[model samples]
Target chain A: MNESWDEIGQLFKNARSIVILSHVRPDGDAYGSSLGLAWTLRALGKEVLVCNEDGMARSYRFLPGSEEVVSTPKTAPQGCDIVIAVDTSTQERLGPTFALWNRKVDINLDHHASNTCYGTWNLIDPLAPASALVCYKLLQALGWTCPKEAASCFYVGLLTDTNAFRFCPLSPDVFRMAAELVEQGADPLSLSEGAYRNYSIGQFHLLREILAQTVFAWENRVAYYRLTPALLKQTGAENTEVENFLTYLQKVSTVQVAFMLEELEPNLTRVSLRSRAPIDVCQIAQRFGGGGHPRASGIRARIPMAEMEKLLLEEIRQVLQ
Target chain B: MNESWDEIGQLFKNARSIVILSHVRPDGDAYGSSLGLAWTLRALGKEVLVCNEDGMARSYRFLPGSEEVVSTPKTAPQGCDIVIAVDTSTQERLGPTFALWNRKVDINLDHHASNTCYGTWNLIDPLAPASALVCYKLLQALGWTCPKEAASCFYVGLLTDTNAFRFCPLSPDVFRMAAELVEQGADPLSLSEGAYRNYSIGQFHLLREILAQTVFAWENRVAYYRLTPALLKQTGAENTEVENFLTYLQKVSTVQVAFMLEELEPNLTRVSLRSRAPIDVCQIAQRFGGGGHPRASGIRARIPMAEMEKLLLEEIRQVLQ
Candidate 1:
């Protein structure tokens, strides 16, 4: 069950030392929510430690207090008065660090609809655009002001989670929150540069190859790209670098369904699907034993890349028809 | 001299039938500001006609009142009480449409710093970020409520003029205005999709070729791409499609100065320059008889493509040093 804001405030006030955790393979929302809370708590004279399983990425190192986010300790730090997990949908998402913490989660703050109530107290609003936004509203409710550093972190979370405000269901409050954050000294341009325009030369090369091989079918309503091991090797880009390659296909005005097929092995392919129209890609992914949001989903197939592509296309064609 | 909001309101109030004009090769700011103003005036029971020399692009045709925007007529329409220019920086930029209007511009509303103030009553705010914002403020000051359609148009202008809020000097008012517009029924997601994600598949192909030929100089501080006639031919893309090719190079995190050299003819190469760092690209463009803002500028060189590239590289290297 979710706890009231007053109860959460009391918990924070009583705690002298706090530990913040987010999901493994942290994104901006994970780092932003965790660091934002850490900075706010520190401003209130509380000792806060922020931890992530994989630590921080090189691109996001520019964020203030990013240096302070340490790798999840082998054992929980002594005298941790409260354990707060933010942006983690479930306890398992906290990775190996979850096993190290002997105490129950004091609070679980998140915005994911799939978030399990895995804490003694939970403050989850699935309607909130970003977990950082959920954290911001919590601070507002607690009558605590966000520090400039905290504002910057939260702003990154908001910006990245919304894909620079391109995603759907953006409320007026979203813009209002953005305005408040900017007023609180969040540098939108610098933050946007750090979060988005920091792509490496190698990543650009990989994008080039992907764009060149882009294929369109079903009267150009469907677009797809394939990334093979040879392509990755030639571009000197890691598999992770191609995560956003689907954006190029999405940019096509006629495309309703766009996807990427990554050849993980000779007979192993990873397929990512995105829908711009009224299509439930998650349903299709679920058929292949994968799951995600309706608009975006993924599936890992044991079949060869060509076979998987054919199967996915036929499935998509039926849906389109 | 610029006119006060009250004076501008009086002009709008006295007019019965008005013609709104924007610059040629109209971008979102041009289309958005003109249509936004047109919708506001029409809501007040005034007759409004929107005109652009180039008419509306297919991408922006989705905007409300876009269908009403006519190409510059052979001559001005009869019974037009006033001629108002929305986003035109100079009378010349109004293109051949300027000559067709027998009367002088009654009001010139713009946000460009380089605005020539070519109208009898000009309202220009260099720091407003978008001309649509300037127009929005005028409507606000006049105590006129923006129609939902007007709000939608203004939102597009704000989104595109600021490059989706990634540009510099974004004041708190920008986000606040965005919130107000959204509250007034502007659809951010659809508006953004219309403005940004409507690229053609051919454009993507051109971008791929540009990315493949991307060159890094000065230890990666300078990145550039050449759009040769051959590449365009092979991709089956028009020259105009490559206008934003510099954006790909701008995405390179290490790049300080990024540029694109398009071979217009055998000896004529058009170069566009963009600076991420504090390096002034305008000065470099000026030396080659070209001009634009400090961060973004362009030049048309009569020299061959390779020679022009060499000259620009030397110029940028000196500035980078």
Candidate 2:
């Protein structure tokens, strides 16, 4: 059993009410973790409420307990013994459930390197593949059977964060745990369709336009593509449609640093950078006060595109030099 | 400088004929390594003869020296000073050029963990991401400028083998070499289109079916999906469609042991497995005399579907236990 998991197991055992919350506009990892944990808690005969800042997409409904998720933070259950944030880092990221934490013990479970330790008992291992992985460890330490539905939820969380075992830098232990889950009945077909094939036609069209608009610079070693707010408005694609677009930029053969800049507003750009090798975007992102993993890191900088490009090029160039 | 790279550089300085051969049904790693190395040799004023068993896909045409490749083994120059097998490990995997190596000095450069060490000079480091990375190091040690073209080829090899940095258990050295390649101008946009978005509609449709049909044995904690010859024939998808299908399976949260069973014949199956942790598929595969890396491993066995399933389940059960 993982260290500190015993405490988490006891925390679940003693709790009369639990509210499970994750980051706003939750990713597969966050949503999966919250639901997986909630499912296991419910299986254990506890009253568990799962919530997020926003509603989940249609594709993710296959998750066993997704239908029970309540999106509005203001509707959070009162007087919970514990409030667990699955993958949310900042308080602002907690959305409606932001207030729920003030009334009870806050347990933060995250894998982000930038976690602020806002919870009383912070379990933030940046090296962890996903929040569900953390939840799985807690469940395992508690000696729970980890029902089939719960295992599936955890599996989805692991695979999504790791990009299907291609990026998360998962350890041998992750796979072993996953194997145990599979034995318990996690369906890959359902997860893949939910996770990877969730790419709607709208996202596909948006991808085509972004690909066409790609720009090469610094003699092709540096390449970037962007999803403009105007295009999103034109396509009627939601803000979340822009998620995971950075993955598309990596196929280039000569690119050392790949950037996917999404325009959030007139002057705000969310920059996602993936380094092929040697360049740690975490360090680069830290300079901008935004950070993520070493390979794929992001920084949200509010500035004109022209200025943003120049500053970013200068910053990235510094790392290369 | 790499110990023997100077020897290769010197060989290029004095030798006029060079034959580049790659592994069978060459992938991006194999093709990229061959093309990256051939371009470097050509830059040194050598007459390069590149041959392989696989037909070139249009996506690969963008490779720097791809336009110069020869598919027939007969085109190999006679009495070449050195025959560089860029990414081939075993002799049979050398494809059509296996016989030619009998008459020449074969320098095998590979990154496969299952390398057979068949060359007079074997450069096999499973830890390295790809043979293209090795080729880049060799070129660097030779003090050659990694032209934009060479970088492009090297990038493809690295990008593909690492599954875009998802597959390769990369280290600091890989990134450093990537930085050197970037200094010489590798265009990422073109590479993305060539390597990723180039998937055909047929392949996409096939992927959809595979995603739909994936099966998860929750009790055994093994998730599996299969593609039958009948299914491929019905869908008009080929073995090539199997390329990225395993990635879809690897995403399932509950599946620790993810597998793709492709029917090679009436009763033959090509089993590809991806593990998240404790299970070493390589050792598991070696039980059937097949082998691969610890996390992602493979084996080809001809057995009844029921028997194969049972055997695989038994092994998986043991690995999980």
Candidate 3:
């Protein structure tokens, strides 16, 4: 990785115009590292362009340079000399129809252990908590001062990828980096509000309805909630708002497996699953032709909500056994 | 504060036995700093007896040395030559039966700006995020190595007092201290679970019920929820479980003020209030003879729930106006 980083640094040094790319449906870390690195490169007199298939998460709009992210890159910059992908594990994940004039990836900076090392130069550390941390270190190695704006972006990256610092992989180095960033003028409270606290009233209403109607099975070890069109209409919430609803269900201490069943259509239900230790939810999602990390996963099923719930419960029970 | 700290250090050096006391109904900082200081003192071969009017919060039972806290101290410990009060602004807040055999308070360490400086030697910094930070600095000033146990205690203090680092008091120093503590063996994941993640299944049920029945008024800016006795009875939730219910209410972006009205008696209701900036909830609670911080407060009213809601709404409206 050190040798690869040295090569990546050489690529960065040689590039006069660069485009930073991240995976589609970009998260805070995606935007954070891309924009953060873009700003750092720009500070060093390099022309930088940041592109993502999905512009930015709405909650993260307050982050610096978030508005400048190009969602659709129809024409690459005429003088574009390098393409650096960040927080992207796979090339296809960078989004369909995304290409820099058919140019190969010059540099890849990521934290996924499964990285394929497809780039000409790869600086990947799967053990890193977030790619933004890697970006900060790269900036230091490149001899660039981390501006407050870039620091805020990195802070958001760290805060969100760690689920507001509650997730695992929050090493001492991460905390120290956070402190240094904050000292450089990253407002943690405001960044926290932007990343985690900025929820619409409709989401709360929907959450409440779902929580009240939750069903517990297997001695309360399997908890699941259902959200139908009616509930969505009543609360005025969009489908995106349901992304984190399972977290509340997972909060139930006895719930080894928690899930949310959302009625995308009369016969189509979108299932989001979460599990604690001793249960692997991703496997269940994979069984249904979907996949994600071990603890969290999702799948869309062509079954009724009740039947799907029963099936999921049985599957989860088997996994527990 | 430095001169006072120096005197405080001298007292620590002179005393062979010390008893650390915090305010009644001790919080995480109280337990953390007391235990943290106690461990450091013990390592230095000084006898330390940590006492609290109320023992550690049940969630903090995972903290090392928490079991040694003497909740019902019939008398001060034998040979106790120094009494260091921590996280307590006033001496009376230490509890009704607390005293050092009629001796003067040898030292007072706190973070509250309103500290009365009631000790012979006072080291109070209202700007400090938590008393535990003060304790860490004191340990450094006294040249004591912070063992892993002490570090874990301090981490809990920092995590809880900052409300898991989302609160406004999280300065750069707090993060640095957290990093140092983690380096000394403080497990962030375990500490987080101990402080915020451990919730009973019944609490979730009760929370669900509250959210479903929430009442929104003032353009959904003033959202309040009611918790009836029947609901609590049905869910088997203790009254103390409702302490953090207002957090959900506060999550709504449009909600400028949020409160929970719980029935404490047939015609008596306890109202817990929370608000964002530009509104001082403490002032609102004061109108009903309750006092607390600007963001959170509470009051008990001897009126029916509906009438109390109306009255509180009017008061809040007037404040908004």
What are the TM-scores, per candidate, against the unseen true structure? 0.94, 0.56, 0.89
| Clashing residue pairs for model 1 | none
Predicted candidate 1 versus true structure: per-residue lDDT over B31-112, tens digit per residue:
9999999999999999988988887777688799899999888788888989999887788779875676666888999987
Proportion of true contacts reproduced by candidate 2: 0.02
TM-score quality measure for candidate 1: 0.94
* Model 1 Cα lDDT, one tens digit per residue, A1-321: 376877788888999999999987688889989999999999999999998888777667868899999998988899999999998877877988667766688899998877788999988898888999999999999999899999999999998888788846789999999999999989998998888778777787788778778899999989998888898889887565466777778888888899999898899988989887478898899888766667777788798999999999999998983
How much native contact recovery, as a fraction, does model 3 achieve?
Answer: 0.64
The digit string of per-residue lDDT tens for model 3 on A30-66 reads 8889988887788888998888887666766888988
Per candidate, the number of residue pairs that clash is 0, 23, 0
Error of 2 at A84 (Å): 0.7
Best by the DockQ measure:
1
Regions of model 2 farther than 4 Å from truth: A1-6, A96-101, B1-24, B28-52, B55-321
- Higher-DockQ candidate among 2 and 3? 3
**What lDDT does the true structure give each of the candidates?**
0.85, 0.71, 0.80
What's the TM for model 2? 0.56
**Chain A accuracy as TM-score for every candidate:** 0.90, 0.91, 0.86
